[model samples]
Target chain A: MATKKKVTRKNTTTNKAKAKTKTPEETSPAMDNPYISASFWKAMWIICSISVLLEFFIHRHKHFEDLESSVLGNISNWFGFYGMFGLIACSGSILLAKGLSVFLKANEDYYDDTP
Target chain B: MRIITMTLLNNIPPAFLLIIGAFVLLILPARARKVGAIALAFFGVYAVSQLVEGSNVTPEFLGFDLTLLRVDSTSKSFGYIFTLSAFGALIFSWSERCRLQNTAALVYVGSALGVVFAGDMISWYLFWELMAISSTFLILARNNKRSRLAAQRYILVHLGGGLVLLTGILLTIHETGSIDFTKENIYQNTVAKNFILIGILINAAAVPFSSWLPDAYPESTIFGGVILSAYTTKTAVYTLVRGFPGEEILIPIGCIMAVYGIIYALLENDIRRILAYSIINQVGFMICGIGIGTKLAIAGVVASTFCSIIYTSLLWMAAGAVMYRTNKSKCTELGGLYKTMPITMVLVMIGALAVSGAPLTSGFISKTLITAAAEHQNYLWAWLALKVASAGIMLHTGIKFPFFVFFNVDRGLRSKEAPRAMIAGMSLMAFLCIYLGLNPGQLYSIIPNSDILVEQVSFYAIYIKHFDHVATKFQMLLFSGLSFFLFLPMLKRTRTISIDFDWFYRKGAKLLYSGIDKTFNSINRAAEHIVIKTFLPSLVKFIINAPASLTIMLFRPIWEESLSADKTNIKKREQKIISQFSSGTFPVAYSAIFILIFIAILIFLGRSLS
Candidate 1:
């Protein structure tokens, strides 16, 4: 993926040079030189792992005790329930937005000539 | 001198001080304007702080008692923040050269303070409209065509909302025979209550009427955007908490707005528009808390309003700084800015984290109170939806805003740091975000209904006493961060806008205009053709020939008997007489003779009948 981005950048730069125009892509550095290093990703992963793991040692109170015990016992009480719920909720909202964009998205000038 | 100062402070409303100072600032020389504005704002804050509880300044107007300076816990909380933010915004815009914008900002801030302290519906309505009118100049001060158009639409919508509020106030006054703005008087008239609610909801940017914020705020000047973000909807939220607490309908409306804001922000390209939409989302939490009406929920709403104003303004300041230096506001056009503008990047990240309710930020402390209030009341669905909205906020604003603007693929843009004034202003707000988060007690002690809130469900005690609660929040927020990276590929920025409720007006207004043009204009044209073109000319012709024809008939027998002539000569003589009468050559004698004869015939018929 990184290699493909670099190739695209090179082609765009050549095209921009031929046209003799100052494009943003021409001034921008290659996409391969990422500002966020590999160490940052590792640190983030470790933090996430610890957060999920800490849920096990902590005693959680049941906000919906009766409903949880009767219908789906201990599911919300599980160690990574909060983490799993967060993950699902975030992804689900993104997917929903993607679907919504099909109908709602328009060009930026959609209302410019409205009158 | 000391006694005079004390009397002045005690008797005068703080709003009046700021308003009067605005006019005074306008006359000062250019160089001293900034100092004047800052001093005025600071004095305004001092006056608000010195206000005693209960009504301080009550003046009679047209036989109605007007409470211009009502100091209660709620009003004081809002007054303190409103004036403080005004002071900060004045500092932020210290270098702004537009004199009109400066005066307008002062008046806008003054009117908002007025709304907070007003105790009568008449005074409240007056200040409400004043706020709407003065704030429009902030957008207009951008002085571009787009900003002009946006300001036009902004004022029209606000004025329309003001009319609706006035109608409700009038009806309530008529029904109750009093103009007090208390909750009981408002609830006295059922129809008036709903009208007032709808009017306030429009200002609150509740779902359908919410498009005005995103439509207008992004078009304001950089500093103007910072000030704009703090006041308008929050004032509406203040009114909501004051007037319509425990209205169950607000729960659903707030939930929909919370999710609606996130969905649109996800697809938005403009960085400022994204922030504008998030304003709607944040206000959703406050509105939902008001719907709960629990002492804890009201406390949460007040605390969050204070915190949200600070963090949101900080975010706008950062965005404004970038726009000021680079002259770009699109997320797709901005990137790698973090490399050069590190201070701005850090401040913006702090704001983003605070908005996402990260553990040690203002959002975490205040937002939890609302959700916890929901849970305590056994509102399982509201609790779940709020949790989802919280995570969604993390995705849209917390991660998406900063990443796209500063840390996305480098676009090779380089710029200097924001102005010293802008940086100082943002730092003040950033400090407040963390300070309030770490010490909830400081915020809790100032929020309205704190005594009741502590006795009911103490948010302060919960965080201080329970470690698991903090851990649970961390687990959710951290995992949401994990999900963002996992799905980073799908979160691509596009040069597009998402259609919102404003489309009804932006596009629907055009449709309405054309429809009216097609329907009514055509009818008008047809009427013009019949009346002026066809019917009027013929009527004039008939009127011109009528007297001649009538006279010819009346004189035909007389001419036939009196003249001895051939048929051709008789015909010629009659035609000549008719022409003379039609041309007015016969003078007034002919007309007078005909009129006398007609009247004599009418009199003969009357005598015969008698």
Candidate 2:
């Protein structure tokens, strides 16, 4: 290993930056994992409750108009019944993808680019 | 012009032409095969031109019963570009004439042509699968392990998608009793709409299913790469416009694919894979257009489709040319090539900038329509997302591909320019890009309800038309340009694989196989213990002891009584057992029963573990 390092070092014009890429073999205790970060859940809770509030207002409006999609096109199209549902659905899918990414995350060397 | 009315029928001309081309290549000499492919390209071009120039609401083929080959304006425009794509690829491949390559690629191109031209669903499906298989062999003809593996994977994916399509078609037929390819009103049931859309979306490289195109394309042979770029995803766009033009879900799906493809491309190392992802990115704009479902949006779809076909072919040609000259692929290993292969470097740079939507290029004229339509609707979030993605495109593809391959720090390669045939083909495409960009009116004429409306002055004309109101696109172009140069320091050639949708299947399959293997091994060990510890040894002991005891027992009983009772207990048992064996063959049956009892004891022991 030392000999291999010597060979590479001879080729490089400088030896300083090489230490950064010679990564530690095991866990690095200092680096924070984003999946476990407090802010992630905090962000999710805030956005989701906000969405629930928006859904409440939308339903109250839908009760007044009594139309499902309101084909009137501009102002009334703002708070249709489906609009609230669509936003909730979007949030669900986005969070699911985020959850999946965390569960499926691997070490930095996951797949080698060159065979 | 008089519009001709005729019955809905399908033509066998294109299919016959393809088969005949394959047969000629197989039997004829190599030179003849090259001539045959060129002639076929001209034949297709003439037919397509007639369809495009003629003024008609609908057209038909004469042979297949009631199957249509009608020419809607949108379809006619697509057919024109498909033919041109075939011509460009055919011209580029003229230098090499491997028999299977020629046969398969011609059939593949013809099959795509058939799909584009078909007016009904059944005929469209027939050519769709044909395109899949025929193009797969184009990859296989490269005859390397990687290429063969890639070919197999490509076929697997398309065949799987074909199954989904088949189920959808069967259900649709059962439900509607009509297989007409005219714009489908399939939103009657939500579940059925999802089934039909899933099948089409798979082919369009919508996020989860899109990895296959980039995964398979880089491994194809050079000429095969050109044809590979053109067909599959575009067919999905064709089907989308046909089936679900105004469906609301596609807007987000297309938006995701547009941005996802660009980001992955930023991480991509292979030149062709970069182009492949860009194909998805380019198609995203079209998909978004189809979602808009207005006349202007359809016009946007038309222009984007036309531009995508030409630019994609050009980009692939550039990659192929580089691969042909220097066998090295990774951008890190390639540089300083432009100084030697100046023609290649220049044509490729043109292609690169066009993909970036540089002004006075094909991309500039075509991509604006969709983004303009989005802004026209005041879809502020959607518009911002698309604009950011367009700029990202310049970062990933427009600069990375040509910049890395041609202008990177020199790696000492001094290869010559591409073959004359390749250069000529690229020149043809380059000329078309500039010509169309300068006079987009030529292309706009073919678009329904929009003709000769692409004057540069019209960009600032007081009208609210797309060409007039493309200020944001110009901003994207400028900002992307500035960002690329500013972030030049951040750019470096590094080898890395982006974890795409394929990573899920690849890594998940590995874990699944290991789990199943572990379960099977435990079951096998339990069975082995039962057989070894009890069944086999018990059978051996029964055979040996039974024969000896039966024969000796009779004599031992007589001798024991005479010899005296002194040896008593131990001797008595042995004598009795020997006498029993010597007496009869009944001892053998007794021993067999004992063996069966021992085997049952072993089974009890194994069961006791639980």
Query: What are the chain A TM-scores for all the models, listed individually?
Result: 0.62, 0.27
lDDT of the candidates, in the order given: 0.86, 0.69
Report the Cα interface RMSD of each model, rounded to 1 decimal.
3.4, 14.9
Which residue pairs show collisions in model 2? B549-B581, B549-B582, B550-B581, B550-B582, B551-B581, B551-B582, B552-B578, B553-B578, B553-B579, B554-B579
Taking the tens digit of each residue's C-alpha lDDT, what string does model 1 give over B1-610?
Answer: 9778877787788888888899988988877988999899898888887778888577888789898987898888999899988888888887788888788988998999999999999899999999999999999999998899999999999999998998999999999999887889999999999899999999999989999999999999998898899999999999998898888888888888898888888888899999999999999988998998888888889988998998999999888999998999998788878878888889998999999998778998889889988877766667777888888899889988999888877777878888889888888888988888787777888888788556324445656467687888888888788787877767777788889888998899999999999999999999999999999999998898887777678877777787754668678877887789666677688678878999999999999999
**C-alpha RMSD in Å of predicted model 2 compared with the true structure:** 13.4
**lDDT at residue B296 of model 2 (Cα atoms):** 68
Tens digit of lDDT per residue, candidate 2, span B521-544? Answer: 988887788888888899888886
**Using Cα atoms with residue i matched to residue i, what is each candidate's TM-score against the true structure?**
0.83, 0.70
* TM-score of candidate 1 chain A against the true chain A: 0.62
Evaluate every candidate with DockQ and list the scores.
Answer: 0.38, 0.03
Q: Which segments of model 1 are wrong by more than 4 Å?
A: A1-39, A66-78, B1-4, B452-464, B519-610
lDDT of 1 at A58: 73
For candidate 2, the TM-score is 0.70
